[model samples]
Target chain A: EPEVTQTPSHQVTQMGQEVILRCVPISNHLYFYWYRQILGQKVEFLVSFYNNEISEKSEIFDDQFSVERPDGSNFTLKIRSTKLEDSAMYFCASTGTDQETQYFGPGTRLLVL
Target chain B: QKEVEQDPGPLSVPEGAIVSLNCTYSNSAFQYFMWYRQYSRKGPELLMYTYSSGNKEDGRFTAQVDKSSKYISLFIRDSQPSDSATYLCAMGGSSGNQFYFGTGTSLTVIP
Candidate 1:
């Protein structure tokens, strides 16, 4: 079965440096999303993307965060400047038109030191 | 208050025991409910999906939703050691693709 895939399973970056996390959602899916989980915390929604534009975003998605569907298959999340609190496991998810179920990738663990 | 709430349990059970996981939500607009399983340091994997209020069973797992009470549950029958993981409950409204997730419950099935 097809599944969402993400690159750079693990990343370590210096504080204030930029980091771009990449994801390739299922080919036929129309909606994509990003979520993050801090250690010992619940999964938090970041943003949702559809039709090349942001459909919805949570307060956690602030000025430093941006998402792009640069190509038909690639969806990227860029953090302009990372903070120590930014360290967390970032997950990418996608769903078909039904929009009921979301498939998630293995996740990229980001560490901003 | 948080949109969704769950007891973060480090519940341990013997192999072959049944496991029950649950979540409650404050949002009445949520129509889609899901349960996901995640191993340590890994992303969540979809386990069960239900719409509105009802019950759904797949393999040895069962999911129950009570929209009136704003509660949901996932039950694992004849659990095994492989069932050890954190279970998260997620719900979304019909308006968009955004989903609200529970804090997750950790379970350990010792063989």
Candidate 2:
């Protein structure tokens, strides 16, 4: 079965440094999303992408965060400057259509010091 | 109020026992309900997806949605030790492209 895949299973960065998380969604999926979960907290949606552009974003998706479908298969989330609060597990997901069940990748754990 | 609320249970059960997990939501417009299972240090894996209000069954897993009461549930019968994981309930609506998730309930099935 086709599955979403994310690179760099774990990353550690210093404060004020930049980090980019990458994901390769299922080949036939049309919608991609980024979500994050702070330790002991619920998973929160950050942004949704479709048709090569952002379809929607949450308040947590602020100026420091950006997402891009850099190519046919790669989707990325770049955090300009990492902070202690930015430490969390970031998940990438994809769906064949909007409002459908999404498939999630194993997730990239980011730890900022 | 939070859009979706779930009890964060570290619920433990013996093998072959039945397990029930539940969640409630404040959004009346939510029409899509889903359950996901996540192992420690892993992203959530979709286990069941239901549209509107009804019961959906897949093997030993059953999902129930009550839109009027803003509630949903996942039931696992003849549960095995491998079924131990964190269960999360998520709801989505037409107005939003994102799904609001509940704090997951952790389960441990002892053999």
Candidate 3:
């Protein structure tokens, strides 16, 4: 199976600082998304992007959160200002079409101080 | 109530044991059901996917969905020690882009 790859498997930054997590989705996939799992919690969807625009976002995706498909193959999630609660395992996933299975990248563990 | 509910199990069983993992959902509009396995801090790996209701089997794993009951299940036969991980049940609404995931159930298949 084709795979999605995320950079910086682990990142640690201070509170109030900015951070960007990058992912290289499968070449043919058109829809991309970001989800995060806090310790001992279910994976929650943050946002979904397609056609270079966000299609849907969850409540957890507040003003501090943003997503950008910077180039043809890369999708990124940026936190304008990190908070302590922001620490979690952020997962990037992509799918060929809607209602289909999403393939996930290894994941980027973000640690906000 | 949560849209999706699954038992967070630290279910331990010996190799060759039959394992049953289950989830219950409240929404009737959900059109797709899926199960994923995550190991430690790694991302989820899709193990089985089914549409609507019924059962689908692959090798040692089987997935069943009963839409009328709003219940779904995954059964692993002859479980191996390598199967130890967290299993999450996820459902997709009619819109496809949005999905609801259950708190994963952790399982340890003892050798």
Candidate 4:
């Protein structure tokens, strides 16, 4: 079956540096999302993207966060400046239609020091 | 209060035992319910999906949703060691594409 895939399975960056987490959602998917999980916490929604625009975002998706669908298949989350608290497992998900099942990628583990 | 509530259990059971996992939500607008499984250091994999109220079964796994009570459940029959993982319940509504997830319940099926 086709699945969402992310690059840089794990990343280590300085506290103030910028980081970009990349995802290639299923080719035919129209909606994309980003979610994060702090080590042992519940998965938290970050943002949702559709039609090259943001559809919804959570409080955690503040000024530092931005999402882009620079190409047909690539969906990326960029953090302008990383904070220690920003370290978490970031997952990219995509769904073919509204209210459809969302498929998740393996996730990118971001570690800030 | 948390929008979705779930037990973060490290529930351990022996092989062939049945496993029951559940989650409750405060949002009445949530119309779609789903269950996901995550292995250590990996992303979540979709296990079951349900719309509104009713039961959905896929092989040995069964998903039950009670919209009136705002509760959902996932049951694993004859569980195996490979079933050891964290199970997360997620809910979504018609208004948006985002999903709210509960703290996952970790299960260990020892063979």
Candidate 5:
């Protein structure tokens, strides 16, 4: 089955540095999303992208976070400046249609020290 | 109150046991319910999906949704050691694409 795939399975970055987590959602998917889970915490929604624009973003998706579908298959989340609390597993998901079940990628584990 | 609530269980069971996992939500608008399985340090894998208040079964797994009570459940039958994982409940509505997730229940099935 086709699945969402993410690059840089694990990343270590210094606080105040920048990091870009990349995902290649299923080719035919129209909606893409980013979510994060802190260690021992629930997954938190970050943002959703459709039509190459952000559809909705949560409060945690503040100034430092941005998402881009620079190409047809690539969806990326960039943290302009990382913080220690930013350490978590970032996941990318996609659904083929509105209200369809989303399929998730293996995730990119981000650790900022 | 949290949008979703799930018991963070470290529940242990013997192989062949039936495991029931559940979640409750405060949002009445939620129309889409899903159950995901996650191994430690990995992303969630979709296990079940339900559109509204109903029951859906896939192979040995069954999913139940009670929208009136705002509750959902995932049942695993004849569990195996490979079934050991953290199960998360997620839901969303037509209003937007964002989903609310539970803290996840950890289960261990011993063979």
Candidate 6:
């Protein structure tokens, strides 16, 4: 079955540096999302993208966070500046249609020191 | 209060036993309920999807949602050791694409 795939399975960055997490959602999917889970915490929604624009975003998706579908197949999340509290596992998900099941990627484990 | 609440159990059950996992949410607008399974060091895998307050069964797994009570459950019958994983409950609505998740319940099905 086709699945969402993310690049840089693991990343280590210094505090105040920038990081970009990339994902290639299923080719036919129309809706894309980004979520994060802090260690020992629940998964938190970050943002949702559709039609090459953001449909929704959470409070955690503040000034430092931005998402771009620079190409037809690539969805990228960029953190302009990483903070220590930003360490977490980021997952990318996609759904083929509205109100459909969202499939998740293996996730990118980000560590900011 | 948290929007979604789960037991966060590191529960252990013998193989062939029944497993019950549950979650509660504060939002009443949530119409799409789903269960996701995550193994150690892996992302969540979709297990069950329920559109409204009803019961849905697939193989050894059953998903139940009670919109009136704002509760949902996932039951695994005749559980196997391979069923060990953390189960998360997710909720979404039609108004937007945003989704919410509960703290996962970790289960260990031992042989």
Chain B TM-scores per candidate, in order, are 0.98, 0.97, 0.98, 0.98, 0.98, 0.97
lDDT per residue (tens digit) for residues B1-111 in model 3: 899999998899999999999999999999899999999999999999998889999999999999999999999999999999999999997677877899999999999
True lDDT of residue B82, candidate 2: 95
For B18-99, candidate 4 gives per-residue lDDT tens digits of 9999999998999889999999989999999998999999999999999888899999999999999999999999865889
How much lDDT does each candidate structure score? 0.96, 0.94, 0.94, 0.94, 0.95, 0.94
Alpha-carbon lDDT of model 4 = 0.94
CAPRI-style class, candidate 6: medium
Candidate 6 error regions (>4 Å): none
> On residues B1-111, what C-alpha lDDT tens digit does candidate 1 reach at each position?
999999999999999999999999999999999999999999899999999999999999999999999999999999999999999999999965889999999999998
Question: In Å, what is the interface RMSD of model 1?
Answer: 0.8
lDDT of 6: 0.94
For candidate 1, the lDDT comes to 0.96
TM-score of chain A of each: 0.99, 0.97, 0.97, 0.98, 0.98, 0.98
Tens digits of per-residue lDDT for model 2 on B24-98?
999898988999999999999999999899999999999999988999999999999999999999989974479
lDDT against true structure, model 3: 0.94
**Judged by DockQ cut-offs, is candidate 1 incorrect, acceptable, medium or high?**
high
Q: Is the docking of candidate 2 incorrect, acceptable, medium or high quality?
A: medium
Candidate number that wins on DockQ, 3 or 6: 3
Give the Å error, residue A15, model 6.
0.9
* Model 5 lDDT tens row, A15-96: 9999999999999999999999999999999999998899999999999999999988899999999999999999999998
Model 2 chain A is weakest, by summed lDDT over 10 consecutive residues, at A94-103
Residue pairs with colliding backbones in model 1 are: none
**Candidate 5 clashes between residue pairs 3 or more apart in a chain or in different chains:** none
| lDDT at B88, model 6 | 96
Every candidate's DockQ is 0.87, 0.76, 0.83, 0.83, 0.81, 0.80
lDDT of 5 by residue, B1-111 (tens): 999999999999999999999999999999999999999998899999999899999999999999999999999999999999999999999754999999999999999
Candidate RMSDs in order: 0.6, 0.9, 0.8, 0.8, 0.8, 0.9
> What would the C-alpha RMSD of candidate 4 be, to one decimal place?
0.8
Clashes of each: 0, 0, 0, 0, 0, 0
Tens digits of per-residue lDDT for model 2 on A10-108?
Answer: 999999999999999999888899999998999999999988999999999999999999889999999999999999999999988555688899999
Native contact fraction, candidates in order? 0.86, 0.79, 0.77, 0.86, 0.86, 0.81
